[model samples]
Target chain A: MTETAPRPTLEAVAARAGVSRATVSRVVNGGDGVRGPLVERVRRAVEELGYVPNQAARSLVTKRHDAVAVVVAEPETRVFADPFFALQLRGISKELTAHDSQLVLLLTEGRADHARVGRYLAGGHVDGALVFSLHLDDPLPELVQRAGVPTVFGGRPGWGEGTRSAVYVDSDNRGGARDAVRHLVGLGRRRIAHITGALDQTSAVDRLDGFRDVMVDAAPGLIAEGDFTPAGGERAMGELLERCPDLDAVFAANDLTASGALRVLRAQGRRVPEDVAVIGFDDMLPVAEQTDPPLTTVRQDIEEMGRLMARLLLRGLRGRGGEPGVGGTPSSVVLPTTLVRRASA
Target chain B: MTETAPRPTLEAVAARAGVSRATVSRVVNGGDGVRGPLVERVRRAVEELGYVPNQAARSLVTKRHDAVAVVVAEPETRVFADPFFALQLRGISKELTAHDSQLVLLLTEGRADHARVGRYLAGGHVDGALVFSLHLDDPLPELVQRAGVPTVFGGRPGWGEGTRSAVYVDSDNRGGARDAVRHLVGLGRRRIAHITGALDQTSAVDRLDGFRDVMVDAAPGLIAEGDFTPAGGERAMGELLERCPDLDAVFAANDLTASGALRVLRAQGRRVPEDVAVIGFDDMLPVAEQTDPPLTTVRQDIEEMGRLMARLLLRGLRGRGGEPGVGGTPSSVVLPTTLVRRASA
Candidate 1:
């Protein structure tokens, strides 16, 4: 192995610059009470010796770590594969990097890992947190809120109520669902069945409610539950077909589920758009664009949502209070969704 | 906003425990000079006050951060969607968490972010680094090596040479590709085509080399470049068909690319397996299993590869020298891959 030289010490730099150790420390920590000549000499010595101050020492002086925790309360491997997770992280990563703040990720294995995250937050390891607690049953929001860290949620946390201090950034899931259903209705499809996502998640419940909002007092047989996977979509589609063979259109909760439904429709000899118009949420390009006939779906800015979460957290950290729509108590931002028309619907 | 009580100070904990400030500090920093009863009293006071030792002060005494940086030099959004990245992260995250360390993710946007990453590493912000520098021209490996933190690479690295100190964890790309081609050969396939991933990456380059090993002196027209994307597969497959209309089989660089090839095959009226056999690398289940005819491909334990990298880095940090296959100098582990047969082949 190639031997690596030990990190250059402050003493080494001081000796090279012909200055005292205190002077070198003063120059490195913003050059307070130091002359310009001494500072320049110290800086040149630092550059020449590749000297970098220990983060621990610098952090002690500043009383802050320029880092934020992105805690994800997801144990399932499925979520990791979802482009939704990846894109959101990218957005957050980009935003944090631009602010010169590091992203310290904390992935929890559901309830079992919640305490660890709680301790980490209370430990002052990071300045703030952006938490993703997707399920209504997830107790993470409460734990995180109790930790007393300035936090912004990724989605409308599943507690199903307005909390004055809970700040969150979410897309208009219910509104998007309404748009998908309305589009199906505009295409003259009345008996439109719905394939919902995992009911545990607020997004799915809201989407189902959106379907109900448009199809008020609709037939009970018109909806089937899905777990937001292709296999789940396939099973729900088969069940829907058995229950209502004459249904004219279908709106799936997300693109992956819609693709699965497409397969079942194709297998059952139903031509998409001709026999059954299909629309999905989250116009996740890879799946939405690659489906058999392509899929007409709702497009939410997933990456933008991530960026907004970081922005909101950073703003809060800067102590900018009472900013409308964000950076204050009761802060919330709901991004709008758009309908992307394709051959499927 | 609900008010958060201030963090309890070390002095407060000492006063609560009815002990000297020095005794409380000693107990908190592992109780070397304190008796068992005094340590127990300090512990109770800490638990009651919910006191967490300041990381900066602790690090000042211990000279360790108990954190590892996972540096990925990928600017594009594509890799995030690739399960390879997510699964690997999950693996590394799990290992680090179990060891009571944190994972600091550094997502680089190519060259512009390289200097920042180097500075972060050299700043002694983390105990070590696990770097993923996929491209050949990536200057990251050199920068990281110069930073001199104990490090491990994700893939075999693109430099294509044996370095005595370069430690990495990579799947057996060449061997996996060999097995894929052998399966085609067993099925009496001739005029086999190869759709290569981005040649800048070592994994893609190795897979391409593997194909050449099986079909020595094969026609140059049989090979086409792909960027390890579904769209790339579609484009490369079309070119291959145009150049050699009678091509009987294809080995795509990865599953996403193979799915694209499958779509093109369906569009071109070529019956899969019957008319044109297809196989892909990296059996990314969501893509591989969802393809029209499903996909026959090589399966690499991506998550396990991630775990191995973390394990090796941790072992090296422990200063456990000369453990074979890992932890010593030239620590590298090439995990084997297997062919998963499905409907496509």
Candidate 2:
């Protein structure tokens, strides 16, 4: 039964408190110029009237919008459906709120949208930018850096071509992939096929390299590629089955892809574990639990990746610059990936 | 082979275009006095110099932040893991970009963070606000409305107690649930147990009501409640199994819960669709395909909901201070849902 209410402004608070507008501003901003008695009065007025300072006004003086943009280079549909991205976004949002900053999300998958995004980011739209899921030779890193804004990448740049070093946080993809493939070999699978993510990304390339390093001595000639999408996994599985029919097991780059491969295998009348063991990366709960026979996969701490990225960007915003030299702890982190065993592989 | 680059500025663009800063501003803003030829010249200069305007200077003139805040009233962990919220965000981000606005995300699940979010939103930090997952009696709607900012809700308010008449875009929860249950009944499923979402949400209440309304005349003593989470579904399912050992079907409030219920049924040696038919709401792609024996569910167009919400909010923002009846239709929109039948049900 609340009535229509007028919003309380700073001027209203100042008038109610019997003080000047400057005095109210000083109190609201916690400046040292305000007297104790006046500050107490202003606080009382703010509480009573529910006066909230306009963010636009504050940004005019501080030049800080108290907002950060999170740009992900993925398809719009994938961005929404991918739990990894969602978890990271949640983590970033939580951390930004603690610092009184807001997180702006931007998806730049379409080539046509790139120009528009560049303009938005360059136009003083946000205080900083956090770019995730970078591919080799992406122009975004260079574009953001040249604009003179503080920017952070969510994962390490695979190409290693940018002049301005990027501050990034990433999982130990190489080690995780190695561990997964080694586990398959240990399970006595003589012929193991690998379903890889998009090769343009370091995540895909690194995982493939790790698998190859393990297969060099144990099993070989069972590698295929996918675009980290379910459909792509299904297509890749079809090709793999056609080429390597005797493959005893498969390792997919992600859980979505693994689910797709499982569907394809089942359609083709293959029994899980007994005939063809399957493993996936990114132990997303829904995908892992619902996959036929469940999926034994690799797990990445996606939430931690988000937290570390936020912390890194905040440090850069505070003028800490990039971490020291090359191989000087890499200015990037590689979190460990654990193997989660289930009925499938 | 890139070199250390300097940040672009209005001065740089002016110098490159052989124009004054005032002329450059006019071109950048598409101000009235600018001629077409000169505007093109200035644009080319901006492109060449990669000039990004200083946000502080822009704020001084426009008094707009060019940003909107998307607040999720859920924990950071769940916000990302939940596909419903994630897809909504994705749709919102796309629409905001089309309107040339930045999207700022906020998570206010923890009680300790609520006050901070209220202050931030109230502080004029964002031009508009989009809130999702409102529980009954939540203070955010009132707080935002009292701030005089345009606010939009993702779902309909159940209790309807707030001062602000929120413009919301909701899925047809009632109809979708009815359709799901009707399908099960069409398959001759009596004693159909109903697993609901959180009862506090209108969606959960409406969906449960839909099931009961259809079942009361057709069948009785076949209702159970779940919290719409997978674990909640599993637990509720276990309880329901004990209560009605002869139940023939179940209608879960969401895909996650249905997936969980499927797992429990499998563990209990129930043959899906043969011994017990099961249906779920929110036809999430992974859950539909990956659940053992697959799942039949209701599909709510998540992306469309997001797009519609963005369009509505944009209309509201444009029609500010005018009559609320300007947007061709009432601010509230309820989109229809479809039944997607698969193997399980």
Candidate 3:
């Protein structure tokens, strides 16, 4: 982000007029309550220097850029390939666009980018920020917090403990996972296996917790760790099958993983929903709908979540740092998820 | 984009020092070739008014924002759903990150955004711009050209005719399509069909042109229009199959379209490669590799194209608009594509 060009400043105007900076500021800001002679002198100085009051006032006093920084702290660009990132960004972009605000997408890659993002957030270029800090140890949460800008996390921040007041918008990962597992139980699935996303992420952790909430006494062989990818799902599924060949149900962390699991199951000559049923999370459109049997998974309104995050942030910024949200401090919001039944389950 | 806050201007310092603006500029910029008394007077004035020399010089003279605008003139958010967008953006981001420049993404929606983008480019907020204007009727090319900013197009700009001097980086869509069709012909398959992408986009149009380059005067029933989506491919493939049941091979404009076509063929009990040798362009990894029998497609280096676009734009900006490329104008580059054969073809 950059300014158009250098312009005359109040300090310079005051220096030229041999007046105090405060007097120049007062005269420039409509000359309200300032002496007539002082106003005349300031006006003459401003005229000579070509000073534009609105530019300075808008940037300095009001501090409105009409731009919001969307910080994605993912190290890899693979996030772009995921429909979840796309849908969520669509939601955020639409919301911000509606508000006459520009979206400054800050794609932070690796450790070096952390400081860059931190500096950018603190640089006061954008009025506020909407960040995604999915991993448990992601430094984005702390850096953005330290930046002292009004920020809303895209998902639940994983910088655990003591930060209860952090504002966020997230899908009900635990509840959704619980519903997915319980749905399998309703189908009389006994040896139900769970394929987890990378444990480093809070969403994956919550999902695993949800699975545990239902199958408290399930065998150790029933749970397999995945990395929220098709390959990870395939590997996890293969592991679960080898350990417990009779597992009748598989619950994947996301649609991508589930798609991979589906491929593996088909390769092994198992009939989906007959010999084994599968349920994925995130109900990603093409992945879920285009799968061989289509996917029965938990539906999280990703775009809506993005829109809500922006809406919340804008609401917090409503009074321009005054009168905050409904209860003064903008609180975290957890959106509910739906179990969309399809042919797979 | 914003400034930190207003500070003392050189004009004001000159005024305070009772010297010429040029004298102040020279004194502030290291006091080179300026008289000692004038330099001392400017230095005192600068200190008194708290003016920063580098900030002014950087923003005004050199005009190095260290920021590049990536203007994606896409009305619908569906572009985000495409893996092509992800890969290209990843390439651009990585390149910009390496160059210590910020990627300021400008996602324009509908007619209103055209002027906004034009204004931003002309506003000189960024040092340069990388624009994507795929649709033939897109107003972006004209607007950006009118803005007079050094810009590089991500794809061949659709502002046809009299744009011979325009700089762009594109995959050899036509050549790639020709190769794909030629390969299908080598497989001893006649009565081949083609699934085209949305004809409005240059990539799709080029692919269609490429298909016709080989087929020449094939039956009208052999060509179907797809919107570069699996659903579109499915719809087009259904139409083609209905029109020409004896067609032995299918060439799709893109991987997404091919995926859709494959699904339709499978539902109709047609065996790929054996019954219909299927080929798709843009060998998108997961989409091409994950298909049932896998797909043999034309592989264009999308990421490399993105990197090259940035590189070209940066080259044009090398001397801050003084000197351009080797021949005074940055010439457009067209990257070659290769046929990636898998099980399907």
> Which model scores highest in lDDT?
1
For residue B114, give model 3's deviation from the true position in Å.
Answer: 3.6
lDDT of each: 0.82, 0.78, 0.80
- lDDT by residue (B108-149, candidate 3, tens digit) is 446676665665555445678887745777777766665556
Could you give the CAPRI-style class of model 2? Answer: acceptable
A155-242 per-residue lDDT for model 2 (tens digits): 7776644534666788888888889888988889878999999999989998898888888853444777798888989999998999
Q: Please, what are the lDDT tens digits per residue for candidate 2 over residues B189-267? A: 8778898899888999999889877887633445667887899889988988998899999999999999999999999
Winner on DockQ between 1 and 3 is: 1
- DockQ of every predicted complex: 0.30, 0.32, 0.10
- The predicted structure with the larger lDDT, 1 or 2, is 1
TM-score for each candidate, following the candidate numbering: 0.81, 0.81, 0.73
* Candidate 3 steric clashes: 0
Q: Write the per-residue lDDT of candidate 1 for residues A152-187, one digit (tens) a residue.
A: 888877673323457789999999999999999999
Query: Of the native A-B interface contacts, what share survives in model 2?
Result: 0.35
